[model samples]
Target: MTMVSDLFNSREIALGVWLMIAIIAVLFGKSTRSGFGGVLKALFVWNLMSWLAGMAVYISAFIYLFYRIGLWTPDLLKDTVFYILFSATVSMFKANKISEDKHFFLEMLKDNLKAGILLEFLIGQYTFDLWVELLIVPAAVLLAGMQAFAANDAKYAAVNKLINSIWFISGGFVIYHVVDSVIQHFHELLSLGVLRQILLVPNLTLVFIPFLYVLSLRMVYEEQFIMLSFKLRDKKLLRFSKRQAILKFNTDLRGLKRWVNRWNLSHPQTREEILVTIDAFKTQQYLEKAPPVVLPQQGWSPYVAKDWLPDEKLKPAFYDPAYEEKWSARSGNLKLDKDWSGNGITYSVTGTRLAADHLELRLAAYESKKLDELHAIFKERVALLYKNATGVEAPLKLTNAISRKKNIHFRQGIYFISLEKSIWGNITEGYDLIFTISTKND
Candidate 1:
């Protein structure tokens, strides 16, 4: 019974529970199985690298400092605190992308907090210089609560925030006291003056707390994004050339910076690292002289339609009005016509022989807002149909890139596409897509 009681309250038990939560969250959370696997792989790599580098730095720094002071005795408290800074710095230099998915991000938060808690407990067993609970508990609660707020996760936000407030207040009361106590003890041991000890010890540990907080919250999560992207690449789902991948990496870096800036705007250490990623991306060679996007209009030509169906006249077609019903009436300034204006445009064969069949489709939107909506609907529907019927790629890139001409057009084997914009003194606007298809069965 005594053993059972002790086992339940142990720090090892706490760490195990925390790890189990992280694993469950990642596996059943907002990601696919493959994505969760990638996230775990990335976290392991990040932690492994950080641990190795931190141990090396800790050993070298410890040996040099002891030798300089002629003190051969090891100071576990100071050593553990100092080592955290080195480990966290290594993580910063090798930054990773953060995910847009909230589940993956939450899993990373729990995993990192668990790691910190385990570290605090392991180090605490050696030295009772500081209260481990005061440091790790508040840090974990604060990170988890802040993440909930950032993600707008309603289920846990209110409860987390309330509990975090108590822990934060309690932790605040002990932070400086604990650091000072640890510093004072070391000062007496080395016979260092008050001023020197104050400068040497508290500054590093004091600075380390905020770093550890942010690191536990974000860095591990960011690395998972890179792994996710690599997994997509491996599956042939995302096809990108080497140059495109670099460009995409730069974009992800910017996105991660934006996410960090939103949650922890005032963290100077994080801000500096974010700035470094931005500068590095902007200086890339491919992006330096990229051409500005253009949408040009090409005049219509009476080209023979492929596999043309023999029809007496071009058929009338109208744009779907249901797509704009939601936002079309939101602003009173814009008004949509109550009827399909099939007579807005007309087309017919011109030559005497009328040797080739020709067809044209035209649509119109009266309200400026509806014009944008119309464009989106037309593009998506047409792309869908094209993909379904022919098993070919949609022409979205070509459509978006064309210059804004009066009759911008393009033709594939048997289909031609174009759009017309309606403007009335710049106050009212409308647009339509003209698509022609052959009905030949042969």
Candidate 2:
């Protein structure tokens, strides 16, 4: 009981409170995922040891520098150390890109120097009250959240400008405060005025660490998003469902665009290159999966005339292979005169060999009251053939035609279909459809 009581006593309670506050700041500022569950995952599932080691290195370096500069009293040193630890903890979460690289210790040392940790430590010397130091995390979080919110939408553009102004003014203030504090603390022993002038540019440059940290987070998120997209693309392609694959690609691409748009609004320097990369990926995927130009030769024909009609009711020309062979041999434009007639309807068929492994066929129906019936039958047959060839449902639908264009255009696997209606002079004449299918390229 005594041991347990000792753990929860005054100093321990204060330490626990500071730890809780530090965790909250990390949850808001550094976590890439969302929600309380996401926090748990980030805390427990991620590389916790790496994060701790990185934070420890950064805090130790800052403390050593501050100690060398005589910036800490023995009593004040404990609080200063805690405050530095809190700041470093919030900044260090998910900093694996720098901290876990090859030359990890050297990289961490470089990061501490490059990220203005010493300047922040100097500022902390003057702002050592626990309450004042506590406010720093909340202030940083608010500013970061506001900046992110502003980036997310144009409606918050005014807010974004205001935030930029705040960052500028706050950076200037930080520089002034550090310069003045140094002058006040070491006036007798050093030419602090000359030192201040010498340090001005570097201090000004480093004061924008908050903004830089946000940008770093965005870069990390972009890398993770890209890797995930590649995995998703591979997984969806392996499933071999054209409709699902295209749908999922479009959905994910839209999300990526929105994310990039926010990032572009926040940081426009890389917008053009980023958009170019995205467009290139889109074009590459489209070209890789695009339907073949030539139609497949297997299980394909322009025999809607013969197949749809009962054999007993068919004309003799329907039974002749030479009839189709003659049309197949003729490469130029189709002629209406070379057509088959049956049951008050006329069918004109044309076949063109586009490649060794593929064929293109056109089937036209004329003087037929059963145009709708013929179209439905033909569409069903084509769809079934497509399903058998691709092992997936045909992504085909009836679309409205415009200005003599095809009413339906669909592609699945290596097959393409263009189904259209031929209209003329207030007469519902017929249907003209083209089919192209090609064997999978080796």
Candidate 3:
């Protein structure tokens, strides 16, 4: 209570409190992966220098403005002192070591002068009662909350516009009252001397208040990010299902990305590494839950007999005449397609004849299974079919498919097989087995 009273009653006390706030803001306002030491350097080294430079720029602007307005006599040293203190407060609050802009201080000065002029010159004159002054704080906070919600959620745009109008109108009334008091008592207020002017407080405190509010808001978001990071690091799967964990991780990652963009921080390699680890973990979990792989039966080939012909040996149940017109329109080739069921699994078969001696066959199986498991199963099927057709062992390995990262290709004599996984929209949907047999060059 005593300190709060001193803050309003003594300019020195108020200035000291503002300085302490600035120091605290500098100490914790950065996104540092280097821990405590990095925060200390930000406060005492890089940010300190930036704040000092910004302060010098703002103070110069304030002094030049005062001189241009004919209010810069020797007796106005008190006003100059207040301006210096005010500039230091603003500079410390706005300083950023990593992403500071060269024009930031100039922009800050322009904005401050514009705000002051709008409040003092354009608003005319008015006054408010003590009760009204007390009500303004809660009213402003409520309106601010509405504005924040409206900004984030598009459904509240009309409400946001209304809130903005209310703020502008209320601001004009407050400004008129403040400017009126200053104008009507200008000479008598000047006579109160430096100490009294300092005690009464300039509009500097108003400027300082907004900075404090913004700093506090930033701190709140930083604390939220820290909490989210900790949640991501926790390894208890029992608390959250794999899907829930993934959703939460994605949401937190998006929040972190927004924070990084807003602060203009460098790309976070640590977070990327964490994301990779999480993806590997999720993949492992998915593989553990997937059904066992089943290879195709021995000597069972998607081809009809050993000859590549669409009309000669293809069963009527596995032939679609509709594909002939479709394929011929696109590539001048005759094609056939049908869904073939064997071993309780359905395979989509497509055969296209490029020439009398050349044929392309594709067999695709769709299943909701882990990507790695599906690849393993299809690789074995392709190898088996290739060896049965050519009487030679297919040179295939899991590494061959996995390391190739998308598709695998193997050729033996006139028979060539290419294996690939199916990607439906954004996800790995299934696997494909493609065989091309050409006797033209044989």
How high is each candidate's TM-score? Answer: 0.26, 0.28, 0.29
lDDT of each: 0.40, 0.45, 0.44
Measured with C-alpha atoms, the lDDT of residue 82 in candidate 3 is 58
Cα lDDT tens digits, model 1, 1-442, are 4664343333334544566877787778766667988866876787657754654565457546744765323333443444455544543443332233335444434544453553343233323222453356546776776765644445765776776676688666556555655566654535433333223323333433334344443554445344435434333322332233344444454343333332222222333444453454344222223422321122112222211212223221111111322101010111123323222322322111112223333344444443544445444444543453334776655456322324445565554544544344434544443543322311
Candidate 1, residue 265: Cα displacement in angstroms equals 37
lDDT over C-alpha atoms for residue 172 of model 1: 63
- Identify the leading candidate in terms of lDDT: 2
Span of 10 residues, lowest total lDDT, candidate 2: 312-321
Ranking of predictions according to lDDT: 2, 3, 1
Model 3 spans > 4 angstroms off: 1-86, 92-102, 112-131, 175-424, 427-442
| Number of the top TM-score candidate | 3
lDDT of 3 by residue, 242-298 (tens): 334335444343333333232212222344544554454445334324423322222
Q: How far out, in Å, is residue 423 in model 3? A: 9.2
Q: What is candidate 2's lDDT per residue for 34-130, written digit by digit as tens?
A: 5666757777754565545644565456446645675433434444444445544554543434312335334444654565755654664444334
lDDT, residue 114, candidate 2: 66
